[model samples]
Target: MTTRTSHVDTFARDRLPPPQWQPEFLFELPELQFPDRLNCATELLDRWVAQGQGERLCLQAPGGVRWTYADLQDRANRIAHVLVREMGLVPGNRVLLRAPNNPMMAACWFAVMKAGGIAVATMPLLRAKELGQIIDKAQVSHALCDAALAAELQLAAAQHPVLREIRYFHEETPQGLEAAMARQSPSFDNVHTAADDICLIAFTSGTTGVPKGTMHFHRDVMAVCACWPRHVLKARADDVFIGSPPLAFTFGLGGLLLFPMSIGACSVLLDKASPPMLLEAIPRFGATVLFTAPTSYRAMAAQAGQLRIGAPRGGSLRKCVSAGEALPVATRALWKEHTGIEMIDGIGSTEMLHIFISADEAHARPGATGTVVPGYQACVLDDEGRPVPPGTLGRLAVKGPTGCRYLADERQRQYVQHGWNLTGDAYIVDEDGYFHYQSRTDDLIVSAGYNIAAVEVEDCLLQHPAVAECGVIGVPDEQRGQIVKAFVVLREGHVPSQAMVRELQDFAKRTVAPYKYPRAIEFREQLPRTETGKLQQFKLRSV
Candidate 1:
């Protein structure tokens, strides 16, 4: 593979970890092979149009705007022209993108890639402080953001000298990027980037309170599409993909954008994909595949009867994917009972780029994260980095076509050790070769000399009808090193009372081992969640 590029800003390339620190990449599958010179944007967008799928629907927004492959390519090409000719964006310059999951956000992402600029997509909900960290870390020179989401970006740019320019899109002002796109040529020859060229920088949620930028190559993006989607998802060209995770997150990036586009499928982009909005859109658009978190699935299952009004007869949803957090067994069972569809549970991380362990509908087990995707290799390893015995919980490690490459972060060495990406998740692989998630290594609760997975207690609580949502964590205790504490949100018509707590405690005791039941339960209006909807158990523990 070629190493050098025409990039003027080689900061990302220069700052990459030494070759010895990188995971051993495997492109053994025929589909995983790639040409030495490749630009992902050209393959995912332009190539589809060149192959006569130009008129095929690529994106359908909530406001009734539909864009075909050709439409997307044209918009992206024009945006690329504006970045180069007007903004002086050079190859490998980092470009920040901020917007909801809409057509233009996708266009901006493709445009940055097409122009050979690294695309750093930020979650729209991030504040100035959070955005400032990303801008400063990535050394972003330019930004293309939705007008509605520009306030924070502007504030972030004001604090960083490297962020020299910010361009707004879909704004009424003539100075907006849309205006520039309208004046430029629609056809663009994408920059000839190497397959290993850094194309995206996805930041972690900073559970440790310091975000790390995960660098992914162009081939990494194509690798994810070839692995998970080809093996587990097996989606078709006509499959209508819909999801709630923000595109900034790798889960949503793969599910809503890369996977669907790679298969020449269309996707429904919702600026706000709440349970009600997702439920309504599925029947209206005849969505065949849905992607969301376990929490959302549980919420929808509780309101399944009310969703029948506009839902397709026999249901248009053929597959449901749960990620961004561990999928609770109770949520999976409830979803299957309501929709007649098994929720496909998988485990992935921003560092690896997409889901590497998953099971197809035919093979999905209730509590397992599923088998490793075809192109990846996974194992549970102990502290010494040796593989743990089957059924023993240890750190989950994986290595394949895509792996961790944190930009200029010393933590890269900690994440990737002995040529494997230690994904921070604890798991156990059964004799049957299925992987079962235990908890994040930090989430393991050691109570009275017993290691209890927080998810286990939370899953048990979710089975109770009165519990709408809950997050379990370990709190300090003098007698016991730490004790299980659960923060719960009660369902409507359910009032919190000492009697109710006792009933829930008894219910959990019957469900799991008596010692695993939460010793302390606190009722709240709702649980803390990240922008992507993953439960903030760390926050609950702090409280």
Candidate 2:
């Protein structure tokens, strides 16, 4: 907190975690050394437009919707004007953003930053109950929601009046954002905010339990641009990025919007991103890079032979990125077998903002999550908080240009210890510095005193021809204390039967450790997943 804050409404800054709970940040790259007074929105958007890139294509939406850099800036600047002139927004005010991955959603997000307001983006599918929890937690002052998704937010605001104002986007109603933007001028003077001022509060996926608000600064957003995309991604200025991850989540926010914009590239936003929809949209939109979870990659791999993925082919597509869960060895190999383009697997959390441990196709090992991206340092730690030798499974701890900063929560002590961000992921770093993800620390299974990683069993299950998707969890048992159980969704033609379960169990025994086989197998039509496409094992344990 050495630098003076630019926040006029200082609720977010006032509620920041205590000094001792904040993790240490490292800015090794020149790009990370942001000036004391900075605004990320200007760095990502306004700078490019100023550098004579205004006419270049910047954002694309479904149904042939497209916006150049100049167009996006004009829209965002107008919205920023509306925020100040119409909505009565003040710097540092928390504003809720609710919408799918589209051009309008992106404009609203940038508008908040340009206006010096703290943006709290939420998943479009979040129900009234979940939305209310976030509003109360952040004391959100205003919201800009899509007309189609306004029902849930309206219901949430009724119950949680801490949310002061609500405005819909897209619709031409008098109170809608579009109508308000029509009245404001196109040009706006961007707010001067400190690099350390809080600009965004991203909530966790609530995979473990209650979601915590993770606060990130204006410089933290720019810091990621220097690390992952510059070092690991090596994205081209001409690349067109597209994915299914909602803009609310950091994964999608970086890949679909920030990363592309940083290099004057174009990004395509999808309204409907199912496997079939994505398969059709990828080629139709000529998207070069694809970002999604491993499950989605597995589904798309089934149709890879029929579609055209780039690099070796004539298609524009070239790279595929998988995150939000461990990338099974089977899924990685399948995509390469069908498309001739190796999939890039990485691990990141909302707290860290974007991918920290990742590798390009050239440096990526078969099943590893790859080395830590440049400008960041990671180590595997034992239960006593000491670094362990390579190849031993332990907690993954990282210190980098960006780290976790929970909003005034006591649990902040657990996330940051001794200046390191403990990501709660169990990983095994090899001698060559490649990190192999085992499972979530809490997801570790202890069967008969022998600890086993559920991801290993799930990876083995995925190799079977009949299994389409699966989630592995430890269930209580009297004999072994806890046994590994796998819930599998069979392929379309394969019917659920007793014989099929036996075959899959035997397949697991042959793949890895003989004792790691799932003793209990349950057939499911579909596995539960969060909006970001992460498997919700917490729900599985409850079931």
Candidate 3:
């Protein structure tokens, strides 16, 4: 790929991994082809208006505020003017965006991309210390945050000298970005950026708790849309997308904003999307596609009565996607039973940009994570980075147009090896070519010379009626080197007692291998989880 003239100095491009370490990119698919000079915002947002789709609805907010493609394009252009003329934002300069899933957040994201600036969107729940770390690590110079959620960023900016300017939006005050944007021109030209220009820097937490910045290019954004939504998702232009994952998360960024807009479709944004809120929003907005995690799906399945009001009657919700973590077989079955929709289980990460392994409704299996997405190649590799035989558990390695490019992080070498991105997942591929997720490589527990996948054990425990949530880990034991220990959160009516523990153990034995049953069971009010709702197994291990 040829590097085009970047308006601002390309800090992220300069920090990319060495050429040899980069994965082999594939753009042979007609949909993946792009021009040398391209602006993603122009393609995703502006083109819809230029092509006579301006009147089409683009965004639906919880407050009943709707935006057409023309409205979204005008706001994005005005925000771009604010970034360049008022905020002194230069191309390639990193802009930290902190907001929930709303129209303004989506507009600001496109504005940053339109102005040739890299967007570093953070979750609203991140604390001051975490925000400070991201600000320092990304060398962020400016921020566009929701005025309601600006407290933590204010505290973070106080400590980080690199964060020179902070602008609040969604506020009626004169100092807010929204007010500033209103005064600027609503017509601005998109920056002529290279197809490979870094447009986003997504931060993800590692096992050590430090955040790693994953740099993605404008082409990558378009690549994921072409590969996943075009082939697997197969969403129509009339589809209405809605989801619970925060827009800061890549999963939500793609599903809620990018993918929907790529096809001229619309999306409904909810600032607070709990399970109940999601259930209520579906029929309220006439949502056709849903994106969220498996845990949320499981909770909604348990409360099926609440979902019936806006449920799957008349094919209102044609698709349901589950990601962020592995979708347990039990959760998938329960959700399918409740909604008559087979939950599409996918596995994507900040490093990979979006879902590269998934199946449509037809090819989906109960427990399998589907085949490698089009334009990507995946394989199960052994310790030496060589492909393992079918059905043998090993590291999951994938290579495609989009791959890991850590921003000046040493872990880059560990993540990408020999031109293949080594996803830190333990998986087994069956003869039919479906990937079965066993566990994260770090989550595998070994006890008495047996390698036990914590996910398998947790799945078994989840089948018991008393278990609401569970985390399994290997704890030191004098007798067996290590023993499987389960920290469980019981349902509302269930009592945590010795009898319940015995019953859970017996249930696990009947569900999975006897050796995989939890030797020690500890009940908890709730399991430790990250802001993104992933189980923090390391925290459970310490307990």
Candidate 4:
């Protein structure tokens, strides 16, 4: 929670060009003050509760379930009491939350926050091995999981003695979660929390095998909601936010959780959000504004105009935002032709938490990520850390209030260079000051919004005696955006077979997370190498 002023040496001060371009939009921001100490559950929600605004809906789902602002506050209060009185949850404890997107998951998130504890939201599809790494890394003591996901949670809990309690919630059962919900009073009081209190621990993939926990203070939550939503989405009381990003991701947390509630707006939760699910939910929930990746838009556009996925029956849908990967120009054109609305693409990372460079409809460049947001400053720098000229590709560096602080990891230096958050992206700025994403310099394979490491996968593959050498790279994928493809040189006597490929995959599943396993494999006699004997990934990329 300690706020420090950042100095960006990556920017070329002496050769800096004049500010000839500026973003076009009426940014009439209200004066905002982030408190020195904060608790997102108790502080931000309490402020809205005291406003006594009745009949304003806070959340709704595709299934026709709805909760008003008053209803939301009451549910959060009761859940907080359940965590405290029944579960024996105390301050400073870490609670692992594994569930799909639903009203109950949202309620549980706030309850964890209200109890002065840090909530670790995990993607529901994660297996026991992945869950164990996060539980061990974050030192999570208690877990609240959906009954469906409880099997995996139980498997993970069996490995660690510190994980004392694993509770399951099933909304449909008569004696299930509703029983727990019925026991607590709706008018329970909020816990008093300091501003610097840790509220959430988001895990991001490291270069090594395990993921690192990025801790955020309650003030960081409020800071992100106030600054990012103000600059990007600008939610109003009447707007409905609909998105496909999992709530476990910081992107989804900002869009689905913090932004909407900060303004008393409504959010639509989608449990099974594939392209078809998105097509079904957008109109079913009457979503006014949508948030998702460019890949989703591409998949929906493939359905042509038959889905009628945008804006519903009326012109209620005013905006659409895309992140996670570059918005291909062809994909953007397809969505515009199908829906008659431009899909705004932005670039963000787990390091900075949410989008900092974005394009609004008013001043959008179809292929370019627009100018920097108000509270942040960005620059493109060459290898020596000097600013490059317009139209030149270089490492993008940014400085802002919400920059990353790793959880006891040494790789922090690679990301935080000379006080600026050095993003892995290779990018360029045009004469108009618009930013364009190129590729990742560190070769971090991003498949479906998940950061994966090549060396980690190679390490796992090397464990097999048959593999002499292996290299992993991301190949273009239609659904996932990119998937891991492995190039392997087998041992002199060993031949590559379906059995060998399956063996390598199963080996990776045991050593690392399942998602990191290579989806495609190729056999070779020898790997192309440099004079220094380093494997030339570029040559493998060509094949």
Q: TM-score of every model?
A: 0.83, 0.83, 0.83, 0.87
Model 4 lDDT tens row, 198-267: 6777887665556877766676677677676787666677889988888998888888878888887889
Candidate 3 residues 1-543, lDDT tens each?
A: 486557575777788888877777777788888888888998899899999989999999987799999999999899999999998988999999999889999999999999999999998767676788899898999899999988888988999988987889878899988789879998998889998899999987654446789999998998998998899999999999999877888899999999999999999999988888988888889899999877678778756544653235454788999887777788788887877788788988789999999999899998899999999999999999999999899999998889999999888888889888888889999999999988767754545434466776787788888889998887876434467899999999999899998999888775554667899999999888999999998898776
User: Which residue pairs come into collision in candidate 4?
Assistant: 37-195, 37-196, 38-195
**Best TM-score goes to which candidate?**
4
State, as a TM-score between 0 and 1, how close model 1 is to the true structure. Answer: 0.83
Which ten contiguous residues of candidate 4 have the minimum total lDDT?
5-14
Ranking of candidates on lDDT, top first: 2, 1, 3, 4
Question: lDDT scores for all predictions?
Answer: 0.86, 0.86, 0.85, 0.76
How well does candidate 1 score on lDDT at residue 324?
Answer: 69
Clashes of 1: 0
The alpha-carbon lDDT assigned to residue 140 of candidate 3 equals 94
State how far residue 33 of model 4 sits from its true place (Å): 2.0
Per-residue lDDT for 392-459 in model 1, tens only?
98999999999999898888888899999998888999999999987667655655434466776787
Between candidates 3 and 4, the lDDT winner? 3
